[model samples]
Target: MSLIRKATILRPILYLLVVCSCYGDGGGRILVFPEDGSHWINMKVILQELHARGHDLTVLRSVESWYVPQNSPLYTSVTVNPAPSSEEEDLGPDFFSDLMQRSLALRKMFPLRRFLEQQKDTMAMLLTFHGGALRVISAILDDAVLVNQLRDSRFDLMLTDPAFSAGVLLAQYLHLPMVYNVRWINAGEAHMTIAPTPPSYVPMYNSQLSDRMDILQRTENFLRYVTIYVQERLVIVPIYADLLRRHFPPGADLVSMQRSADMWLMRVDFVLEFPRPTMPNVVYVGGFQCRPAGPLPDELEAFMQSSGEHGVVVMSLGTLVSALPKEVTEAVAKAFALLPQKVVWRFLGERPAFLGNNTLLMDWLPQNDLLGHPKTRAFVAHGGTNGLYEAVYHGVPVLGLPLIFDQFDNVLRLQVRGASRVLEAGTLTTENFLEAIEDVLSNPSYRDSMQKLSRLHRDTPLAPLDSATFWIEYVIRHGGASHLRTNAYDLPWYSYYSLDVVVLLLTPCVALLWVFIFVCSRLCCSRLRRKAKQD
Candidate 1:
């Protein structure tokens, strides 16, 4: 063969070898600290994706964790002892059920009084929750053996849910590059922490206001924003104050440590969230957990098919609150009975007396599969983020009965987009529930709107899960993503807001104005004196 032909063959061989070598690259070892409950569900999806991509993972969970198990093929689980009398460790369906009942009662009070009482209740909850989270952090830090083992593990990065600050504290202690699987931080939404959220338009978490606001609405949002700030500073921050003082440098604070994460895998897509300022390091992996529907069990498939052309409605209240108040459940059951469509509900408590033959109750149902099925028309939901996004993924309209926490805001987003309707679970009645369901089922606009959102959500170049995994690996490859992180986190509040620069700039102008006034006054005095002397 000629020399040119030989060289061409060698080039192709070398390229093939290079491709094979890159494909076989060994994965990084990752340390994960996850929050329990629905948050763990989100984290586990990402972990599964990472595992498939050849990454090794180690997960930390509390001994009394409700969702996280001791064994999983995905990662090695390290269970830690929670603090004695830990409120979070003791949290169960019954606790949230009581809270729902209290919320319902509060809703019946006078508006102003109800607002005050709700704030008081929310503050108490925050204190208890954060206090429990702090105890877990203290437990981990207090253990010399665990701390040494963690340090010796030589992990590439810490991937954590910042809903509790335990992961943030541990990542900082280990001096690891941190990536947050976050929607909420210690105090409020993660965006409020990392982005420039102007209260003029950006609604506070739980505010339930849209991006467009009238004057009074804006005022309410502003107050809510201020309340969150106060809660964070006075309530949540102080929970970690003593720990920071003992383990961290002077002036170290929880918010700053949280903001220092190399990447924020925000679990909100713009399709579902109101437009707001965001940081570069904040990657939106919303609906990352959703996937194409799998084959349903034969019995479930038969039920779905039996609905005929009328279709089916799927309902789930999420992981935390297994069942709503008894009265509310009865109202919902009666409403479901009135629907021509078959209803599949995930109900954990006693069967409602008013339930109809059209409705089927299961302790649990295949939520994603049901939503994706062609027979599935609308979803009755508690407005949990996971379920809402899944509905969006499958283009199913939602009739939301938001009970607590961010559920209200989650449903409101879909309502604003014309994909869902919201009803106050506290005031839910058979008549109103039936009316809303009828409206959702009869209206073609709701399904059309949700389908549009699904298109936009699905049109991304890389899948949300892949995007999340890629950035995580990016941080691992580069050791950290400090270049992508903004320096604003290190700035003091005044500096971050540019208040110091404003004062500095205003000082010279103020001095000039005073000088000009003084000179005029002196001139006037001289003129007056001359006039008097001349007279």
Candidate 2:
């Protein structure tokens, strides 16, 4: 080969070598701090992938860390004692249960307005409590011994899910390079600070409004948006400020600490979400937790096979909600018994008496495995993003019973896209539940819609895991990837949107219009005077 040809052939090879050399075989130590319980499940795939890539990892254990299997990789595990007493164990569960019970209390209120009004009361009560497990964990990290130990560990990077404020605070305390994996679509003040989620167009969390809204819906969404600041400003900000004053370094504030994160791996994609402006620091890694279907356990396989031509339906309400209310369980059980398809439901505590011969109950099931199976017809779920993304991955239609948080919004998006129907858990009835299941099962359109969305979801050139891993390593290689940071975070809302500029430009136009009006009046009066004189 000629010199030019040889050089051209070697160019890409040389680049690859240089890239590999930069990142190197000796990967840096990574510390992962996921909030307790199901939050860990969301980050499992990413952390597992990172561990497989030879990065040294230290994972702080919440009570939920016991779920990690013994055969897992050699990552260092530390169980943090946030409180000396047994009380800390209950804090996480209590925080969630308190919010849920308060939400459920609105059932007696009878109307949407009353529900929202009662919800505000719940928020007020929730804000007054400062002993949440996440806050306690942050305090534990602030302990002098723990802080000194973490600092001495010389961790090159820290990864955390910012469900609570602790992750950001902990990162700030340790002065480590940080990356956040936010597992929600609309991360309250965080997205508002980094991205422009216009309230008129983008729906607020739990608002139950679609992307395209009518006048009333837009007004409601705007009102909801305004209320979001009440919690952020009144509750989250003040508490974190006190935490900073009490435990963390003096120089850092919440906004700056949050902005300092190198990259935010968000669990959202354009396939399911409305198109909106996003900053460079925000990366959409929606299906990071989804995986190819593995073989089901023998009994499950046999059960699926027993469904015959009618196929099977899988129902799961996700990890946080282990059991539904007794009446709700009976309603779901009644609906499932009527279906020709076999049903596998995830339930805890006790099986309802109404459960039929065609249905099976388990405290846990291999959800993704069942969804990917050919015999699976539809999914009945709580519309958690994790489950929704898996359904999208496997091309299964959904019947969503949205109970709380962003589940409502997830189901709303699914309904808009013609992939699912939603029923409010509080007001759900046996008849409505039965009709929805039949509609999704009997109609081919739901399946077709889901298939189309699944195609779009998987059509990206790189798989989500690959994309996430690349960016994560990229951050490590480049020493925090500071170039991706946007100046938008530094600007005030009015300045960023250029409201002042709009007023400034409009001033000249208004002045010119007045000048023309005055000139016209003067000319008319002059003509009238001349005519009068002439007369």
Candidate 3:
């Protein structure tokens, strides 16, 4: 071959190498489902971030979570299921809701044997999950990789979010590592579960601490947690069994199936928590806030700009709890009318009549973008954990009107942390709403306090995102997730539940009873002997 021909071949190969170098990198069999709206956003943010860092993102999305009531206790109300009504009754969403509500209420009251016997039809429908759970399971099973997202603690993992049991079973059968995350406030936060209102002010909230009842009121609160633990097992075990029957015919021991978890990543930071003991498995990464803002839409940007007198107060009850019922809307609108500042509320549906000229209601708003604005003063919200992070990230104060599970807890935590005030839903009238809003707005101290907490929230040695990236990369390189797991798994449920005490107590009682019987028999024998001698 001539030198001229060799040079020509090398030139083409060099050009190809340059093109390959310019176009960077390789990728995961990641399967993600955004069944919940905010959850979708959450995954999107992570997906984008990961993609930027060279990841193959596979997101299974549906309109749920932050936008709708799909993931909560109320989602099934929109579905349709039928019972064999006189061999001809057809069931609609309304019928499903009514039937579901009755059965759920009954499950609370009935013991296992009674519930199983009476709830045959309801259980059949619930297990079938014609609404959507089965479909999600099928989708997950079909995914290239199984990523069992432990976003909620349903049956300790994704094992039992009611109908989603099938999804959990599918993930397990595929040998997927359950990725645990705290999509809400840290459960380990010091007994913040106690009622928010002072015992004396219980009348205001129209409630009483369930634990405050007399002996007959039932010592259930203490036992309730343990009962729930058992109940979770009962629910998941059956579903697991059912799925195994239909699928994993080879079978798996229950203990081994339960034991399999690759890693647990906490979506919370210790700064957000009220100081309490936490296990090693519980990685404290509360700083994993939503990805920061980009450009805002033109309309949203304009809506946020106003004079000092017209302040922006963002009110959203989150996606699942979006149905603000007419009364709540009117109450909120009336409260906004009372406030001197203009309110930009991300309200769903038609605007309320009580909404004043100063108030602007829209179906959607750029949440973090609005908060990041300098004029934005305070946030009135349902106290979702993600929302709390947004407010903190922006150095804004908040008035929390919590309506459901853990919302009240988050509100109280904010109150205790001096970051916000809790506005009880029962007393959430126009006056009370304005009062709480005014308290957060007028009080420079509250703003300063929140800003202080915000500073603390961000005062890490490394940027939160950087820290998260480092740990994730380290895990991938080392491939040793066992280092992150807690010793809680090693201990038996008896030790965790302290069933040892019951055994100890029963042992002493048995010994005492035996001693009493022995002494009594000896005395009777002696008496008989004396009587015979006398004769």
Candidate 4:
């Protein structure tokens, strides 16, 4: 009788686990790459839910990802090895962190060695970079195709940092769906996808900015253009650049390799983004926030509580951006010492000489939980998109101390929207740092504004992840993605590539010049005739 009762209890618990676990992403061969720092951590929630639903999924993640998905939702990994080491030209952790910006995207028209530097300035790279290890792991993941009843690839979905675009393109050549999950700053290319002209809320792109492309953005755009046109059509050029050659191709340039993405796996809640577009393909799956946020560590919990009502400030530049000079670290240490509130900074280096007991510097921390905690008053952050979404999620006001690249833009966006405070990294006096922190923390208006924006952010009709899933399923349901197709081919380079402004400017100017030249020749001829008559 006791055994019968035990069986009954066990069966229900098993079924409940199954129900909670059923994520439903399905077994239709999906390949995902999220090469953006540890921001790949966000996908843990999405994948777990997918696995519970009994979907066959694989992850191309960091070599350090075993801890992330240790047991529950089994997924494979493929790692792109860090650049080989050398004493002559080595940039450590910071370079690797910002390598996405520095390196020409893997999919650029040029070769890898051309844009790919020998080493990045990441301490993480210095500690963990083993090319042989990554290569070995990659070789194993390469066989992901054969592991099945699934059989012969359906479509692959790649979602990674822009630096990983070359890998995305290679997968596309294998006839897989390529999608970039907005883990952090959407690369300049992806930002251009939803280019913020007039109507879009993230107004980063405009004619004004275009006129100010700073040599770097223009260079990035040019490489992208060349990739799609010249590189994709290498075998066909000049006379051979004929469209007819596409029909005669045996070992052609594989225009199929030129990936036409169906949509982006925008890991942001549409609720957060205002003035959202009404596009068919774009979907928001952001705020799949904490499936992997297993439990808060006890010391972090104790640390927050021990601070009394003074509250605590959490400082981190996300994972990738931690590589900075000792001078910057010293300035940060001095600033933290000055804060009345206890500060916990996730600095991935040794305890600086300038630091004090008021400061806590560690390699890593439970970022989201700290933000969620009641003792958390203000976030002194690097203004990463993930951090932006989190702070807004909890209604915590931020002191955005942005240092490099998109961080400036991200914080600037926050500052303009009344959602964040931006501090220039270089010129920060400790007094200035404390003033910014104190202003945001003590100012009720800043908190109130953050609260209002938080509500506005969450007002989206659909969760970002749901929208991401909808598009993902939509593509697999409709083979090869015909619906998202644009008549981009029918348009000329000036029109198709949207260089029509150049065409418009040149055409009328050339016509007027021709007219002036014709009149000048005719007048000269008449003068010569009159001179001959006089003679």
Worst 10 residues of 3 by lDDT: 186-195
Instruction: Output the TM-score of candidate 3.
Output: 0.65
TM-score of each: 0.93, 0.85, 0.65, 0.65
| Best of the two (2, 4) by TM-score | 2
Clashing pairs in 3: 36-64, 36-65, 37-64, 37-65, 37-66, 38-66, 268-285, 268-286, 269-286
Model 2: colliding residue pairs = none
Give the Cα RMSD of candidate 3. 12.4
What does the lDDT come to for candidate 2? 0.78
Write down the RMSD of candidate 2 (Cα, Å). Answer: 5.5
> Judged by TM-score, which candidate is best?
1
lDDT of 4 by residue, 212-313 (tens): 355655554455444323321342222222322433345443233322566656655544443434344555665656322334678777777888878999
461: Cα error in model 2, Å: 1.0
As a whole number from 0 to 100, the lDDT of residue 292 in candidate 4 is 25
Q: Which regions in candidate 4 have their CA more than 4 angstroms from the true location?
A: 1-26, 61-73, 78-163, 182-187, 193-259, 267-279, 290-295, 495-535
Q: How do the residues 138-235 of candidate 1 rate in per-residue lDDT, one tens digit apiece?
A: 89999989999999999999999998789999999999999999999755788888988899999888778899999998998888888888988888
Prediction RMSDs, each to the true structure: 4.7, 5.5, 12.4, 10.6
Clashes of 3: 9
Show where candidate 1 strays beyond 4 Å.
Answer: 1-24, 86-90
Residue-level error in angstroms, candidate 3, position 442: 1.0
Q: Write the per-residue lDDT of candidate 3 for residues 1-535, one digit (tens) a residue.
A: 9999999779867865753453333432343333344444444444455556654434333332223333332112122122223312323334433443343344345354533433344334434433344444545444433323422212211211111344335447654444433332111121111112222212111011222344432332333333333433553345445435655657564434433434434556655654444444444455465445667777666666654655677777675454465666798888888777778888776568887877877777778777777768898877777788888887889888766444655666667778888865644577777777888889998899889988888877555554444444334444435666655546686975679978988998999999999999999999999999999
**How far in Å is the alpha carbon of 296 misplaced in model 1?**
0.7
